[model samples]
Target: MTDQPQVSAEKPSEASADQAAPTPEAEAIAAYLLKHPEFFVEHEELLTTLRIPHQRGDTVSLVERQLKLLRDRNIEMRHRLSQLMDVARDNDRLFDKTRRLMLALIDASSLEEVVIAVEDSLRQEFQVPFVSLILFSEKPLPVGRWVSTEDAQKAIGGLISDEKIVCGVLREHELAFLYGAEQGEHVGSSAVVALTHQGLHGVLAIGSRDPQYYKSSVGTLFLSYIAEVLGRVLPRFTQSSRPVY
Candidate 1:
């Protein structure tokens, strides 16, 4: 008879059992905290023990951290509100100036008078350093800085797109065409507003000696509005007769 040896099962050691047990991961803990908002109320002592790092290299309690975040948000909101208020004030002033200019244009009976009114108001009221108006029509207008449509196109056709307002430093050729060579040399930046109504096409050019006076990023709402007003009013002055260039 052959005798078979008996097999015995041994229990796992305490150290091995402890090592095999699953530990809670940081992500799982975070998820649990998010899912159970009331967990903080149950264990409020953790709020005093937990520390968060601040930009100033100081650690703060959870309550203090929350207060800091609220303060930062409040400051940001206040700054944004101040900027909005400033913009509103500026818009109000511009509206008043535009109203006065509109009245002046309406009162002028002749094209020459309208031109004078625009130039004077732009200089005195709007504080524009340099201004020029170029009308494109066959009808003869009072002799001034008026140039033929062909001349104007050759000078600034590429700059203007439909009725869009162009703002930035103008090219040497464009600058010279809008302003005289002597005046152009002094202008560092400019805004050119295109005007079109019926069969009339023209441009109102404003120049400044300061390079930053007119920025490309600046809004052209007021300039476009003025151009629209001019387009409507200036056409009334032009006659059917061909203008002698």
Candidate 2:
């Protein structure tokens, strides 16, 4: 055992230790700064001293970076606010149009007047390009496009099967039936709602040239409401004529 003396393992150098891990003092300072966000306000000189690396590989003072961050946030907020204002203005216009349409529908005396009111309001007031209102009847009516119940079922039975509103790109045949052959070819999307009160009165469908316009039911509330109103009102006029089921 006395032939060889034991040698202790060499300890890591100070430079290696420093490079391996941050000192506790630096970590404590960081933690304290986080806990006291107003620390910079008290020590204004530190703001000029602290630097943040920029995307361009240049360093910017903490104050400049903070100002940039604040400016970016302000711009984003302004953009969001502008969008909200636009939506509000659009809703106001929609409300006014809807009010006018309701009045016209209420004032209508005859079936022809009713048909005229809806078509005119939709085309002129609502600015809808393509509008269709088909009434189902066994016999030809004096006003509006009248399709026999059997024919209506044959053409668009799936659309009028329920009271819920339907929206999206329709098949070529459906588009033709709702908007007509030539006009339907130009229509990219459509929204349809069945008029049902005591019975299935008819179908109300609107079309847009933009394919994405009526892709969903997001903006079809007014269409559905108008259809509901027509359903209830049409029954009053059709009682004598007897609109088929």
Candidate 3:
């Protein structure tokens, strides 16, 4: 099972509760990923292993440079971000019963607003007990008073300090489904995106408390959509509208 950062008020699942604590492979893989999350995008060799399509890779290459692939509306780019935006919009409309909730999710005018909106929408969409939205920067956030799970934070913090992982996962799976029950060895699973400040993209962490949650075998197209949306929104918020004197 993956050791996803479980934040929020939910509990871990029964099957997850029963499984033993992190195995060497699971721990190593998680740690390795945390350190080199860029491997998700940068390492060309691991692209196939991660199942990132070649066309998507090339598209990402162009997207990272902020080049709108308008070469052919008739012939879409290998990976179409417009398609992903359509998914996000549909997701927003589907889950939100009222219009205000939908507006709150997308009317984000700043990074903090974006984080809060994403935390709510994504946790609900992924059916997770807890979730968080993290903004990565060369500068660190003043040590926030809360640490979701002490142990998970410790492991992740270590990797971050050593530059092992790219960004932190904000929710825990173990607690999501296991609430009001027992303390299990297994914990939350996570859906991760590498939030690169340089690339103008941020990670979208969707976590679950179920043992059967996110697997290495699963695809992350939706999570990619989430990241892509944030990538577009954040800069607009930061760009000053006032004229430079």
Q: Using TM-score, give the best candidate's number.
A: 2
Candidate 1 structure quality by residue, lDDT tens digits, 1-245:
79999899999888998775455786688889899977856865555566666455364446675565667778999999999999999999988988888888888788888788888888998888889887776645674456667667777887655667788898998998888888999999998987776544578989899888888738567777778888888777764423222
Q: How are the candidates ranked when ordered by TM-score, highest leading?
A: 2, 1, 3
Error of 2 at 216 (Å): 1.6
- Clashing residue pairs in candidate 2, if any? none
How does model 3 score by TM-score?
Answer: 0.36
In model 2, what is the error at residue 98, expressed in angstroms?
0.8
Clashes per candidate, residues 3 or more apart or on different chains: 4, 0, 25
Clashes by residue pair, model 1: 138-242, 138-243, 139-243, 140-243
Best by lDDT: 2
For 181-217, candidate 2 gives per-residue lDDT tens digits of: 9999999999999888878788999999999999768
Estimate the lDDT of model 3: 0.46
RMSD each, Å: 11.8, 11.7, 32.2
Per-model lDDT: 0.76, 0.84, 0.46
Better of 1 and 2 by lDDT: 2
